[model samples]
Target chain A: MLRKLTVLAAAVGLAFVATSALAASTKEEPVAPSAPWSFDGPFGTYDQAQLQRGYKVYREVCSSCHSMNLLAFRNLGDKGGPFWDPKYKSSVENGYVKAIAKDYQIADIDRDTGDAIKRPGTPADHFVAPFANEAAARASNGGALPPDMSLLARAREGGPDYIYSIVTGYHPAPAGLTVPAGKFYNPYMQGDLSSFWKGDPNKVPVGGFIAMPPPLADGKVSFDDKSPSDLKAEARDVSAFLMWAADPKMEERKQTGLAVMIFLLVFSGILYASYRTLWRNIDHH
Target chain B: MTAHTTYEPKTAIERWLDTRLPIVRLGAEVLEFPTPKNLNYWWTFGGILSFCLATQIVTGIVLAMHYQAGGASAFLSVEQGIMRDVNYGWLIRGIHANGASMFFIAVYIHMFRGMYYGSYKAPRELLWLLGCVIYLLMMATAFMGYVLPWGQMSFWGAKVITNLLGAFPIIGKPITTLLWGGFAVDDPTLNRFFSLHYLLPFLIAAVVALHIWALHVPGNNNPTGVEVKSKADTVPFHPYYTVKDGFAIGVFLILFAVFIFYEPDALGHADNFIAANPLVTPAHIVPEWYFLPFYAILRAIPDKLSGVIAMFGAIAMLFALPWLNTSKVKSMRYRPTSKVYFLVFVVVCLILGWCGAQLPDDAVIPALGKTGINLIDSDLNSYVWLSRIATAYYFAYFLLITPILGLRETPLPVPDSISKPVLAGEAAKKD
Candidate 1:
């Protein structure tokens, strides 16, 4: 009798849960269309060429607004990265990453004066910020702060998909909508509360108006390795690059994970055998 | 020195050590302690939880070696320094992060098993109470650890939870300020949370030791809810339970590894990846998944003070469970009605978790085919009403239904001896 009552009560509770879930699902937000990623599934590894192209796209366009502060110049030449080469070192004498690092000027402290100074970047130096400070960044971009790109791929909801959509999703304002002077309409940018002027619904983008003017265009960036320079290709490349930036050790991690799994499988099998042997003579209730 | 059967030293050196400390004898006795022969797979959770704690502590200590506790550097230290710079840092951090969820998973199963078997009944009441203490400590430790990442959700979650102290009438504001270490959650707050997060786990370890000691005093409770009457009804803890627990641990570790390796962030909110900014708050500020049921209870009430009280009450009610349950019967399996009520309560808890995930006051009924109806404004979108109902039932299940059912319900006939089932099973095996 109690079992029946419990089942009935459970059924009622489950009904409410289902109902609430259904209601919540009705308030739909646009989701990024899935794109094929090289580093998606269990056996997936990063595409060396794709990562290289993505880095190129990031260097030419995205670097102007974004700061990859957490990424060191040495990481670019590390294993699993697009530019990774076992023989390559970030020394000025060595290879391309070293050359790339030297191209930027990083801020350093003056040893004698104990004051900030700028010098050519080194292998250990993090990517230099385009702006001196947040104030400078906002001043240059009409008060909109471009977030650091180091972990951007992991930070957002849809991640690489979201980044790809926003880069290519920019379009003219809708027929009835009037975009404000500083803002540009992008269907993919999910605006925070301050994204638009307060109480001005017409000025708000369908999703959220972003301050960034469309940053990508066909053939805007020239790739030396001869990958496609179309807007979509460029977008894909940059998104892939950001994903690598977010999780550079993914390839190594997955490989180690496989080994761990195999060890656990064999170890557990042995343990189970031992357990059965121990229990063979004893009858459990 | 102990009641349980123990090893006798056969050599002069062994006898010398045994007389001095007797630690080896203590280990032998514990391993040989008689356990109920009727224990099922549910009994394996205790071993799994212990393994989880050890895993967390090991990985956590290594991660802390690279972790920076200050607000400014904490986020970057985790995402960049530990994950990127350290050798196999990602693996260590992933294991630690996912290990927390796994720990909760094992502990929840252990708790539910205890509940189902009426493990809290007298003589074992102190054991159950000690388990509760460990549980509360786990919650506090997990909460502080979550804040250590200093991500968007971490910052806001800390802010929201600490601010709840202000709901107290006279001492609330002062307590909140002291907890925050200033006007709001800042550097000092982060520093203290890290210090306390590090300290509480050791405290939990101590309490866990007591919990085990308390359990040994009375021995483990079994599914039959009957006391061991004869030697035939019990088996040595070693060889029987130790081997079984080892196999279970291996299986549990595989499951834990899947999360660590494959879906490391599947259990976490994405917003947590973003560094915390005082100026910006995420659209929704939610706690870790384990806290959702209590979080739901907190939000169920409209008033701040009442909501806080209700959430604490939910946990406090668990401590009162042993005394509140007046039934002569211990196991719900014997009392069919009690079993039904238990199932309902589990479902109710799950619903509360679901409610916690949703925006409060959101409509439960979908607005499909409704023309020009203002549903968000109406009570439809809100789960406020439903949550209140569920919360009321939660209290009623323990306070009213448990006592009433204990007095009125008749239980199924229990076996007189554990050996009967074993003997019957052996006879069947011959066929």
Candidate 2:
């Protein structure tokens, strides 16, 4: 009985060591990117006009489905303006949207009838949704839940570039390509086994495709002649605007990080010197 | 001691370091202990475990700087930190997350080393108990830390564990509600858990100090079961053990760096990437890998209270181990038969961990279908049977086998003298 127990113990130990060794030996494979089409470029530095165009696209098309719940309406006129151009701040004050205050009261309008007065738009007022609830919204758009765009630029894998590409990538179907049913296909999206395909080769970029059909038609939004004035250019402009919306303080953070790094470098030198001075006499007999 | 009798001019820096870092002398004394000559690589795990603990504390502090504990802002704050906050904030968070896994890896090895060398026996029982306490505290700390991120896994994981309290016959729902700080896990629960997670590491550190103190009292138990009989039996710990432990720490740090730099998120759950959504439930829910063994024990019981008791009992049982074993023998080296039982116990533990990771239904089919026997109708019931059997074996190794084997088993011949020369002479004469 003792011998049997001893053997059993040894076998268990051997098994554990062997299994651990096996686990150690099998190297894990690298994870592939979940989204295939990515925008590759430096994140910072975008043209001012492009941002203006993006705001227009967002206001007209994207705003119907997405809500930037965290943003206050009045913030549009801030230094980095989405509602007003910095160069033409005066034009913003006289624009169609203006702040107004009113009191609720019924007064005689023509001696025979009295009516409650109506109020104008205010900076404090939030953008009203087209649908009352999620069910109503879904009923209008084939049951697909539209994600909030407040942080969409940051949440996605490729930040602004992915958004830009997805917007401009939409086109009619090309020759020799068959798209399946129920699934809207994007040629650029790797690992997408979806069958729905739409896009013409002339309209779409070689590696670009998106489920969202072309949102910007040619000459839809006018920009300065030097700026990207086409639909594709407008798509890129709006993507940049969304990126800024997602992280308004990004530039400030980067600047602060640089300053802190410099301070740490100087501080660490002093600390190292002090540490050496403190330890200098420790070896004495 | 007299070698430094002659006064010599000291460098200014050396004097300054000595004044500020006074603990260096005590550290030197610890490093210089006269360890048994037979000490090997396994003994290095204790030092490596300490290193991991220190790493965790530093990284955890950095992560806490940007982390918001309130449910309203917690998930958003983490995302902001990853996307736009401090530079390399994502890397820092990932390192801390993976560091918890690595710390467990080291402690498990350290604990196993103690068991294998019979370091928990006799005078060192308190040390072993201290270690077990540290392990328990570590589990609680890690569990709470996971919830602080407020991701999908974080929310669901917290809900599932807290709900386990509801399994109790009378006080279950009330207890769970109290734990959650409301009807469900929300801002209040997250806040309290964050506070506790921050506090527990220090508690663990204190226990670890006690563990080391206990260890020093009895010294380390080496591979050989024989006690030190003469001056030749051990070497002074200073230069000898210090260099060995230092070298081992360096090697261990290299491995730690590989994980930290190259594959920081390898150990983390993918579901944690998505923000917490109360409306959407993940298809599969599982605890972190480190908790798998106890999770298996929890699943074993059919009754809610019994399962809770059994899970807690599994850990509590370890405390009574020193007293429970009937075996007189301290080390497996001297007990040929008992060693086999010890190995079998280790396998059972690994099997339980693997089973815990599997879905309950998948685990049940094999047990019933393969054997063509229905010992229990529910998979959980079978798990309970398996755990009970394993738990029985675990205690039996200590309570029954050790004392019994010590008295009955004929041990291999042991050398009488510590010196190799003496043993050599004896061998020559026999030839």
Candidate 3:
């Protein structure tokens, strides 16, 4: 029975690995090259200082074109967030988050007059979009609508890794490859570019034309913590921030999982004991 | 023969209730039911499936409280209102989402176990049919539930699956329009799907009642496929199975919790995180993993109508299984030749599922590309061809092998009773 149980456990582990391999299979080239993600494993936790820097990049650069509609201002100071502090019992009361919210004007209706007006953003308010709707967003950015960044990390194949790859994958198009106007070539973007290549059809370039130009440059945004402001650092930082935005409760989830796992293990062990004991007297075959 | 009741009135209120309703007696009779003594770990799936259904229902109800059925608000309600604002809504939604997968896993195992042991044979045909109905309902529920999130996959999956009806002649267009509540998949489709998604589980629960009732009559089919000859061949459901099933459930929950907490998105598609936009279609559209085998079947043929019929026929095989089988041998353990074919059938299903996930035009073996004559619609060396081959075997296993093999094959000697093998010092653990 124990041998069978061990075999079952191994089969389960193998199956999990196999399914993950199947899911991770993508035609995209340069394959979101693996990076050292702080939150890669079950026990992994987000680096708070890195998240804060990531938030800085997002606010200074990404915020202009992209929306974080799912995120509230107070989320920045919530547990596991960029501006989180132990001293703040609630994120709404966090002075740093409050100050940041105050910098934006939020759309509202005046109670007395019932008229639309812009008001100072509150901690409870969702992030303000750069445009009113998808049409306006597309109109502003050539024809490509900059996707909302709230769930950007999760919405891509490799999560933070994919984000980091796309942000930093911009390069000079190989000779014989037609680079269209207002479109930048990115080696990490998933698409077929065979038709756009004048080179050998079989040996066509491994990337696609992206609408957004290279948004990051070396020393674009100076870090408050004096971290390097190279294009790579900025990309990595923002990628991590987007991941946090996508899964803000990861820390709590992992913690709860650990406890639940331990409890179920113990409970199963007890049940096994009782099962063996109760069935002890019965067995002829 | 009716199962004997063990209930005795303890108090005056119990006496009154026993005579008026007998609900207590019914409950006691179930607990005191004589299950076969030699039933193995494979039998534990019944309990695990019940747990899966209850988990889905409880978590689903919680999710509905926070969910909006409107097309516009549906994505927002799921991504923001539930996942963000509501307390532990992430956990609840994760359980509900992942629970569907878990339910299918348990059910597939249960069904296969029945097939392997021939629990679906003879008097248990109605029981198997009832289980089949439950499975059909489950597929419908899971499909509609996926659409409730209103993600890219949700909208597109609904559009693709519902459009299969449009492949039928004449009435197809009208049925699809009626189903969608409009000409296209939109807000009304989401609303009705929500209503149906909420409605189907209780219907499943009602059928489950009949399934259990049907099972209690025939009792359990043991691993040896031997009927009980005496009291020694059976055991009460209490304590022995209760503890055993409890242990299995606890282990199953550990697996469930691992997905809910550590890797909730592992079983889900990344595109689902993006809100559904009818204006833009995604690069790849795939249904949940459980539906992949059927999806492959649907895509096996080039013609849309034929493909749709083939897909539904795959499910219809299960319903017609008992009648198709001609074998008197109840267990594969006694029918060695038949067992080999059954294993191959399982492998074929897995292959079909893998093919379904790949692009139909993609080569199964890249280096061996273009092994046969190229078709106008699909290459012969591609996943489409692979699926066609597997689908052929899938239908053949039911329509040809089961009946013919049952007639020709020589089975090993069978035990006279459930306890006979043990008395003969044979463990009866070959399965």
TM-score for each of the candidates? 0.91, 0.61, 0.97
Sorted on TM-score, best first, the list reads 3, 1, 2
The regions of model 3 sitting more than 4 angstroms off are A6-28, A32-34, B422-431
User: CA lDDT of each candidate?
Assistant: 0.82, 0.62, 0.88
lDDT of 3 by residue, B1-431 (tens): 26566679899999999889988888888888888888877788899998899999999998989999998899999999898889999999989998887788778878888999999998899999999999999999999999999999899999999999999999999999999999999999999999999999999999999999999988888888888788888889886788888988988888888789987988888889989989889887888877888999999988999999999999999999999989998999889999999999988887887787788888888898676778767778898988999999999999999999999999988878876663344565543
Candidate 1, position B357, lDDT:
75
What tens digits encode model 2's per-residue C-alpha lDDT throughout A1-285? 254245335433433443343232212322222322212221243344555667777777787776655444444544444555455455235242343111111122444455544344454444445566768876766665565676677655445666765665554556545644433444444332223224553343233233344567777777644565676667677777887676554444444444544555565455445534543543210
lDDT score at residue B411, model 2, on the 0-100 scale: 59
RMSD of 3: 1.8
Kindly report the interface RMSD of candidate 1, rounded to 1 decimal: 7.6
Please name the candidate that would achieve the greatest TM-score relative to the true structure: 3
Off by over 4 Å in 2: A1-285, B1-28, B82-84, B169-174, B363-374, B379-408, B415-431
- Candidate 2, B177-293: lDDT as tens digits: 888899988888999999999999999999999988787677777766555566566766654555555555654554444444433334555566567878878756677777777
The TM-score each candidate achieves on chain A is 0.82, 0.61, 0.93
What tier of docking accuracy does candidate 1 attain?
acceptable
